[model samples]
Target: MTAQQPAGGAAIPQRPAVDFGRRYITFETPRFAGRTPRRTMIVCAALALVILGAGLASLTLGAYEVSFGAVIRAIFDPASDPDARQVVFEWRLPRVLFAVLCGAALALSGGIFQSLTRNPLGSPDIIGFGVGAQFGVTLVMIVLELNTYLWKASGALVGGLLTALLVYALASKGGTSAFRLIIVGIGVSAGLGALTSWILITVSVEKAMMAATWGAGSIASLGFDQLAPAALVFAVILVLTLPLTRRLPVLEMGDDAAAALGIDAGRTRFAAVVLGVALIALVTAAAGPISFIALAAPQISQRLTRSNSPMGTLPVMLTGAALVVVSDAVAQLATVPVGVVTVSVGGIYLAWLLAAQYARRA
Candidate 1:
């Protein structure tokens, strides 16, 4: 599984010795470590093309029903048909791109969290990272009465990071056990969510309504400018993340083993939490904490591709894109909020997760 050995490769991260006996743990490094399975690569490529197709479809299809030709023309010759260009590129393209960006961000974040925690259920919404982001938004909307986009986003990032650290600190007493971490996270998230609810209830009715709608998530009128900064935030985090991927497989080898293998578990875990929280917080800030895209994306990606050390980051991104694009389409047609659609779907996935766990235990 070793790639061409570099001079300091082993020095950088001592090649971890991992052996899988008879039993299967999902988090085990693939037998084909350091090399992606050819089939999964092919599937990932197919999913990317499908995502591109969906993006084009989103641009072309709507109430006005622009032709593919017109959409193409509108994209290329903006001055020729200003109205159509506004509809196609300015309006629809941004939304489609938003879905892509949000999807990829959530999925990657979910994968990172799941990898770090070794818990499939470790997404922001369930584990309280999303709650933190929501708390941040609440502060801006309720206390400050200033929902300027960047301020709210800043709130989200701050809140999410703080909450994640608190959760980790509380859970680390007994050695950062995944089960304890998740349980503590659930408690923290519940408390924060209740606090958010209390604030909204106590506030003026108009503000409450606005908060509620935003909380439920809407892309109806979000322009490109509104979504751009969030994209930039995700991009910056992603650049920092690429170097960390190789470290993840080693960190999965338990804290003691990780230390033995020269992988700094504490630092690695911190990096994962920060990245995960930032990703979700930015999306929440931009899109109002939309539903289960973060939760569902990683799980679906893991199941679809069998080699799951958590998951290939790309598949999770693709799965997220598909989930949001599909969920957004449903939201548009059914008069449902994007967040609501995602929750309903996510609830189903959560149920399935519980059932599968029980079955495995039995």
Candidate 2:
């Protein structure tokens, strides 16, 4: 460390730059970051404007006519118009909220899985989360469609959890290996995917068509009836996860360090896994299995914020919201569902991530 000079200049500590055996990774230590408070405020405000403006555009551009002013009025003062209110309140509002909710949940879920696995490639969908949910829904729709929405949600949750649980049991022993987890998750996902395909093929053509449609994760024709409950479920899980942020930091220190810090390492990890899986499941149940927001959001935010760790809450949520809203907008104009856009886009992202991981290994 260097001391300050009398000329109002302070010397700072210097050290030789080291590599992680591949490339150097460094970040602002919650201090000395290039962004000032004013810049951060401006950026956040701009992002909020973008989101709000997009919502207004979405509301007005639909089949029924609702002006920007009317939409705004309806948003603030609940009882605006009997007809326009139905348009904004019943239809557009839920879709917008669902888009935001799904985006936030998926990103948070991605951050958790990546942090837990210590891999940039870790995400629920990448590791068969969508397939798992598909399997769950397939089972429900094929054999038992009588379950209530809550029960159906439970089925989806169990399906995703069991799938991940199977992957972990198969791949992890003494220590969890990021590489192994991905491989196992891929194989398991593939098999589940095959099973899903088989179920679709073997059933009646109408049933198969129905399953195929929902699998794409469309937000089309979604109303408050479904959105309200789904949002509530996701919110509850999200709240439960807030305090566990510290545990995640500790977990990055490895099992031993986590235990040394008085965390029941196994228990903390299990809880994080359950929470992450539950969030993904909620989205999957409500909106069919969304493709890559979980995988893409955390990784994108990691690069954006230049954070050394997986994305924290605020950044990840914003990044996710931006992606889904933008994608949803694309979906509307393209004569396609949101799911197709995500899968296509997410497929490309997954390939790049794989290449990067391989390059780092090399």
Judged by TM-score, which candidate is best? 1
The TM-score that candidate 1 achieves is 0.86
- Model 2 scores a TM of 0.84
lDDT of each: 0.81, 0.79
Q: Each candidate's TM vs. the true structure?
A: 0.86, 0.84
Give per-residue CA lDDT, model 2, range 155-274, as digits (tens). Answer: 788888899889999888866688889888889999999998888888888878877887889887677888878877877887888867778877887888988888887887788888
Runs with alpha carbons beyond 4 Å of true place in candidate 1: 1-35, 76-80
> Model 1, residue 201: displacement in angstroms?
0.9
lDDT of 1 by residue, 179-210 (tens): 89889999999999999999998999999999
RMSD of every candidate to native, in Å, equals 8.0, 6.0
Error of 2 at 191 (Å): 0.2
